[model samples]
Target: MRCVLIISKMQEMSNVLLIIQASLMGVSLTLFFALVLSSLQKTDTTKSYEIVRWLLAFAMLLFAVHYIMQMVFGFRAQGDDVGAVINILFYSPIAYILSYSILRIGCGNNYYRKFRIMSITGTVLISCTFVGGYLYYGSMHMKGALYIMGLLYFFSIVLFIIYPMKEIRRIRKMVDEESGQEPVLFNMYMRTCTKLLWISALCIAFSIFYTPLLVIIGPFFFIALVFYIVCFLALGYNIRQMSNIIVAETEDEVNADGVEAGTVAVKVVMSEERKEMTKALIEGWIKNQGYASSEINSTLLATRLNIPKRQLVQYLREVEGKTFRIWLSDLRLEEAKRLIIEHPEYSTETVAESCGFSRSLLQVKFKEATGFTTNEWRDNHARKS
Candidate 1:
């Protein structure tokens, strides 16, 4: 009787967890759609954002359907087969859309038609095979069908892995062509997307074996649900960041010439003489005053130089082989070193403030750039003097 009560209680808890998971997913989906809609309305040239928004919306919808089906018919003997089939059908499409979205975002918009056809063909093939096999062999003898579906699923995972590699290669080529440099943010973004893809592939592989375990142990579903929700949230955040980057790039192009008109003169590339002059001016300003201000940033520096921030960023990348942040950090580190060595009386807090670095950040950057703490540098220099 006690065991029966415990079992009932466990089942109740499982249902509650499942409902919470579903609600979270639904809310996240709605919020993501709302954000995408807002971006679409506000931005005129968000092709990449549009593709990502729709793909994510579709993926979220499929997830909702899968969860609903699992909740409704997952435990029933007569309905379990149908539920499993529906889940399987939804899984491949969701995976394919997400993989394709990542690819599109990473690779740019060159081969849309080819990718569209491939996506449609793959979806049709997988769906038809699963449905046809179920009808012919029935659920009891559907191992061959499942195997075929699994093989196709694995193929999609392969594409997911392959596309990211292609994206990395594309980025490398771009860096090579554009002055042998890439922005730090660009590199970080690519690495993050690659990591997300690898994780998604692993999750999909785990799900295939996880479903059976879920029947014997209901709590496992809760763990899986949490994992899936967290993954989706992380992916959604990445998509949002990507959308912002696209919007910024579009704005940069539109405002490159300091003209607000819909059409403007083509921007002439900055010549070597001009590049050297700009670099010298920027360096002089930083050395004299900019590094001491805590509020200094790319925009502020650009304003000082009377150039668009994007142009400044490009100049820094092409001429200096560093991002604005890296350039700023180098200046700050130089100032910090001087302060610690030549003016050892100033407290670390004062040095950090005067050098435009926060207290914790000073510690980190000082150690990273000089291989010594602030005090260590000061003591070493004091001994030398």
Candidate 2:
């Protein structure tokens, strides 16, 4: 009698868990549509954003399908041959979608193309194995199909771990080569993606070994899905913020007097006079206008100079042996040091603002450029004066 009661209670709990999972899956699908709509509404969507949105949409669709399959076929009933086949069909694609999405975000276009080709080839090969195994061994040996699929799924997870590490290294290299500052939001997004992949892989592994365990730990899976949903929301928000920044910077460039001076046509062979004139114009713009603003970036500076951003970057690299970011930081840091030494009455905040740096950035750049904290540098300069 006690055993019967325990079994009944377990069954009740399992049903409740499935209901919660279904509800969360519905919420996730709704969020995916919201993201798609948001992306469509954006006036300046980049190729990268488009790819990310499609990948996310496909992933969510797969999840919704999987949820419907569970509800219709009943969870973890090995006796149902059709349900098992449906699981095999839909389950593998989720990993592939996620893996490809991460690869696209983390890698360059050429690298992404190469990895995607490899992924498709692997998928084809796995599908062949599933079909051949099912035909030859029949339903009695469907375990073989499951085993092969599990191995492929595990391989995808390995990629999820490896590629993100490579991506992190690439981002770090970019920071070192161009700017000395990390892109905080981008890094956070990458980390969240990596974490979600890990959790998904673990859940898949658990489900493979002990299907009943999913019923017991279903709430944990739902929690991970919630995290996944939050991560996408954060990504969308970040994309919007980046777009707004670009728009505002462009407007500022347009509003500046003599904006046409910066829009010089790219020339294959610049005459000596034109070269000198262009150089003078760029210098005057930076000194007169750029140095007074804290929100300047390569794009904004290029627009103000009337040159392509790439041309400006190339020119800085060729002539100054510095990236635009480095060159700009040097200009700001030099002015900041001057303010610190010459105007002792100016507060740190005042100096930072005058030098076109935010207070936090001012502290970081001050230490990096001078090998002393802002306060230490100020105190040392005061003593020397």
lDDT of 1: 0.62
TM-score of each: 0.54, 0.67
Instruction: Give lDDT tens digits, candidate 1, residues 304-361.
Output: 8887866787788788788766777877888888777778899999999888778888
Cα lDDT tens digits, model 2, 167-286, are 546544544444433355655766675676567566654464554565555456556655665565556556533321232223243335242455655445444665676688688986
RMSD of each: 9.8, 8.9
Whole-model lDDT per candidate: 0.62, 0.64
What 10-residue stretch in candidate 1 is worst by lDDT? 242-251
The regions of model 2 sitting more than 4 angstroms off are 1-17, 40-43, 79-88, 180-182, 215-225, 240-334, 345-350, 353-356, 367-380
Cα RMSD for candidate 1? 9.8
Highest-scoring model, lDDT: 2
Error of 2 at 324 (Å): 8.9
